[model samples]
Target: MKKRKILIIGLMVVGALALLTGCIPGDGSHTVAKPAGFFSGIWHGWIAPISLVGGLFNKHLRVYEVNNTGWFYDLGFYAAVISGFGGISLFRNKKSKND
Candidate 1:
């Protein structure tokens, strides 16, 4: 059970990384949030891998929704947070065992 939890935590961290890294290029300093295909800039795709893959399979890709922003940093931040929590838990467990 503990291993499974760790695995799940690790996956969550990885998933967060994936989401953060999947961001599109942001606009230049002079440009507004709008860009090519600007109307469909929502970032729904950054939610999960299965959703992205499923959309690709169906040939009805519904990529991101919000423009002028990348998902990478956001996801990366979340991944770090979760991974840090897991690490803290593991470290505490080890310390407890030693004590």
Candidate 2:
């Protein structure tokens, strides 16, 4: 019973993620300009995983913008992705030997 409950919760979480990630619009017509700027890069990076999944089935999907502000946009995107994935544990409290 415990396993069943866990499985259900996991499935729900996965479904929710899919829904959230799948909402980003793709570029099929190639007319829509790529979003630029720092925040936009962060947003794009935050949703990159979802975009990757979307790209798997859709040729028009893109994980990153091609017309961004060069290095700044890339930096923001990478930073957002790293933070989002917990790559750099920012909230963990350090424990000293005294404690």
Candidate 3:
């Protein structure tokens, strides 16, 4: 029980740090460019298509911009949801008639 607590605390700290380092502007002096190979995964790859779909149409030149923003914000939210589940029975969590 104590170990689980500590492990969860550590995961929370790590996740917070990852968010800070990845999203937050560091120092703000440099250009704060995207990290190399940051978008080198299956999830990263979906970002482009998802964002494109998320930003279907607009008169102004804002498709790519909307896509990029949607990619990060939406993907981050989904990642959080997946992590929260801990790969367990989300739908069957409660004591139901089937159980």
Clashes of each: 10, 0, 0
lDDT of 1 at 77: 36
| lDDT ranking of the models | 2, 1, 3
Q: Per-residue lDDT of 1-99 in model 1, one digit per residue for the tens?
A: 999999999999988766654443221221345432321232332333444554565553323333333455345534544554455676563446557
- Whichever of 1 and 3 has more TM-score, that candidate is 1
Clash count, candidate 2: 0
Clashing pairs in model 3?
none
Candidate 1 colliding pairs: 20-72, 41-64, 41-65, 41-66, 42-64, 42-65, 42-66, 43-64, 43-65, 43-66
Task: For residues 4-26, write the lDDT of model 3, one tens digit per residue.
Answer: 99999999998865553332212
Candidate 1 global CA lDDT score: 0.45
Model 2 per-residue lDDT tens digits across residues 45-94: 88988889888998878888776677887898898898888865778787
Better of 1 and 2 by TM-score: 2
Each candidate structure's TM-score, on Cα atoms with residue i matched to residue i, is 0.27, 0.58, 0.25
Which run of 10 residues does model 1 get worst, by summed lDDT? 36-45
For model 1, the superposed segments whose C-alpha errors exceed 4 Å read 24-99
